[model samples]
Target chain A: MDDLWYSEYHTPHVRFSVKVSRQLHYEESKYQKISVFESPEFGRFLTLDGIMMLTERDEFIYHEVITHTAMAVNPEIKNILVIGAGDGGVVRELGKYQGIESIDVVEIDERVVEVCKEFLPQTSCGFEDERVHLHYQDGLKFVRHTDNLYDLIIVDSTDPFGPGEVLFTKEFYGNCYRALTEQGVLINQHESPFYEEDAKAMKSAHRRISHAFPMSFVYQAHIPTYPSGHWLFGFASKSLHPQRDLKADAWNALEIKTKYYNTELHQGAFGLPNYVKEMLKDE
Target chain B: MDDLWYSEYHTPHVRFSVKVSRQLHYEESKYQKISVFESPEFGRFLTLDGIMMLTERDEFIYHEVITHTAMAVNPEIKNILVIGAGDGGVVRELGKYQGIESIDVVEIDERVVEVCKEFLPQTSCGFEDERVHLHYQDGLKFVRHTDNLYDLIIVDSTDPFGPGEVLFTKEFYGNCYRALTEQGVLINQHESPFYEEDAKAMKSAHRRISHAFPMSFVYQAHIPTYPSGHWLFGFASKSLHPQRDLKADAWNALEIKTKYYNTELHQGAFGLPNYVKEMLKDE
Candidate 1:
């Protein structure tokens, strides 16, 4: 009962810790180590490979930002593909949109889904939705082989390490570009710009995606559980620009109540800090 | 050094850890325990009462945010009063403006100033400026008695606990309201809205200040060393509105080179998340 603290090293010299009341569940999945813990502050939270994935208190922000930004951009979005969000939080957010006809989630690990379903029902609730098709396979391979094109593709993978490393490759980005329709918008979890390792990944992802897509940009969000609490998401598309093409009025008409994502903040989030802008520019 | 990790309990359940290479110094002043640690990631970071005050790596965002937002709104600000910024980070930022006439800093703990001067010179350099006047006294008492009026007042105090608890009181805010000129702007380190305790403080500060000032608003910044990485600052003024009265061109004409704060972000930082907006709203 004493000294039960779960800590994750954000960098070699920086770490984040949470005092665990008890271990709810733990299993070394084929892909990584999946564990769930109960805490008074964050509530029941899940971690994959010793890193925080989602917590009950803050999961809404991450899920809402990842899902609603693209949905708001393309109100007519029908088909969507989600990569590596096995917790089903992304699917839960997409389920809110009645216009979204089909959602294909490509997760590398099935254990993440099963464990989340058992221990974390809040984020896993939308897995029961009929439109959500769960494909337990590697996301890198999924984007390469999938014949059906999607209107919006969201890559909700981990950092560019371990199993998530392939998801950031130029080959994978090219495949995502090809798997998308002409008007398709590609968004991925670009790493933070503060730390050295993450910044390198961020710049590399931008370089690759910028080459594949005609119009590409990076937006930022404050996700406390992540490293440095400053997180970035990449937006790349063939034609649509986020600011110019953002139909704020049209999206507001949907009246989808969100905790974090708003039409104005959507535009504001894209107003990257000057340092981040410098990092994203071709060097 | 192998097992040396400095951890701060963000909440009862959540903690943040940094691998300390060595302890720079430690002393218990009349007010609180002040300690400095050297780490590879954050360089030398200072902590008060076992809580992180600032780190060398991310101190720019905090100092830039606390000072420039108000300065940008009121470009004609000349006489400024800073309360509780003993580290001199706020003064260092104010030193950038050549138009600044006199900068008065009121701090309760002389130990914080002396220790930071000996160790954290990057932030303490501005203390040597001839225009900068340092007062090693209680900020709450200084504002009550000082007859001089200031165009801008920056409250760079710590969280509303221990020695900082008095700085967030209604009486203290009323004193600040009196000490300010007709067009003066008051900005304070409003607590984060993510955690419950900090959210309570944030709401209380907003409610009290909103009642005191004719025009009041809350702006946000992403400071990772902080509890939630999402931190807030209160902007209360006698007549000036941050957005409406913002002289972006005037501020830009000054050509103060900054790494974080900019005129565009001066507008964007006020765009709070939906939940934060709800928290700030009168209940």
Candidate 2:
């Protein structure tokens, strides 16, 4: 139609707008509203509840950082359970490692997968692999019910609002802890630290995850589509510390090519600013 | 005034906007259009030619990354030459170390310094320091004419466009190399790599700096007020390698309290992503 612009409220006083050439697709999914847009700069991008989920130009940074940080920490990790990664970006990155035997993706809404597979094949292409098992259900329930323990569990959920609210709670994190193997690692989409609401959510999630796992730390990546362009990921493990247990040589031996994640960056990402360090403190 | 929103074009198709409380000040300097705004989210911010220079909330990330990276690399740095840092953020950060004997700040436009002092004292406080010497003249000319040698040279100029364009050329970089002491370190504001225009500038600056100095590298910081929040800084020196010469223990001994720059991050910031590494490669 006309030159349409979509704006998202990064905070009450800040807004990020992208000029859309056209709306590629739009659907009211069971859990949230999913929309795909075509833009000249960012290429094609998907959004949930009017918030940017991933852009073709920058999704590699997010997915690679989230999936490979834990994988590099524990290269022997075979079984992976991804919750709320309906966009399939997380699973796509995990599929690169031949060592990963099984990948179980639990998405609350099936519509997201359907739309992504139709409109965003670059990310959804991983679903075609035989090792991936898609479970259409609530991730909170799936974690509680699954008797099979996982070597790694990735909470790739959306912002801590609407459909993704429960995933950031203490009960959900507790279930994730119980669902992990002896040396299991849990990585979650920790919120941004720039805005008030996001900082509050980031602190809450860190407190709960830190309580559940003996070791929990936060790392960051530059995701331009996100609120502050700075997005954080939580790394929690039973006995393996992200930095101390880091198998750098082992991960590098895999030769899995990545756009953003590297062994040095893996350790460096945990070197956060002093203010963010104060925000995630145990108090 | 009424409710007003400030918008900056990230790229041709992407826009970043903030709701402005009001325009603190605006002037058409001989070089460019300089404006200041008070925002609820980012606090007071300055703009040159409708592009964000820095914000009160996030200027620490930019200033810290640029100044402390070299300081940590060579803790004995006694004299510094700063070009085009009219806002005074870089000088303020450099003022922290007692070892820093003299700081010469060169600015093409005195209006930027005047406005920031009047409206943004948090960053402009460094101007009051007795050790800081301000020169209201072109940075390119300042570097070429100065017979004085400095241990550190900081090129905190705006994007490589319009008035700030000449500072990114090879001739200017050669002058920076000549104007430095034997163990001198030079840091320049290399633009982001996400947008096409910015990526071009980043590559151009890197190539020139690499040509001038024997050891040249690029580092990044997350500045949300900028185009993509992913900003790069160029580090070049004659004999000092940023990582190899990094005196983490020495820098930490100074005990300078900062919100963003720390020794660990100083090392981590140099860990460039693979994509960025590819971009900076000598083709």
Best by DockQ: 2
Runs of candidate 1 with Cα error greater than 4 angstroms are none
iRMSD for every model: 1.1, 0.8
lDDT of 1 by residue, B1-283 (tens): 4679998888887888898999989999899999999998999999999999999999999999899889888877899999999999999999988889999999999999999999999899979888899999899999999999999999999888899999999999999999999999999999898989989999999999988888889888889899989899989999998888889999999998878888777777787889988888853
lDDT string for model 2 (B172-267, tens) is: 999999999999999998999888999988898888888999999888888888888888999999999988889999889999888888888777
Residue-wise C-alpha lDDT for candidate 1, range A169-274, written one tens digit per residue: 9899999999999889998888898889889999999998988889998888888888888899988999888888988999999999888888878887887777
lDDT of each: 0.90, 0.90
Give the CAPRI class of candidate 2. high
Error of 1 at A89 (Å): 0.7
lDDT for B215 in candidate 1 is: 86
What is the C-alpha lDDT profile of model 2 across A1-283, one tens digit per residue?
A: 5888989998878889998989999988767888999987788999999889999889999999999999998999999899988888898899998889999999999999999999899999979888999999999999999999899999999888898989999999999999999899999999888778988999999998988999999999988899888889999989899998899999999999998889998888998988889898743
Best by TM-score: 2
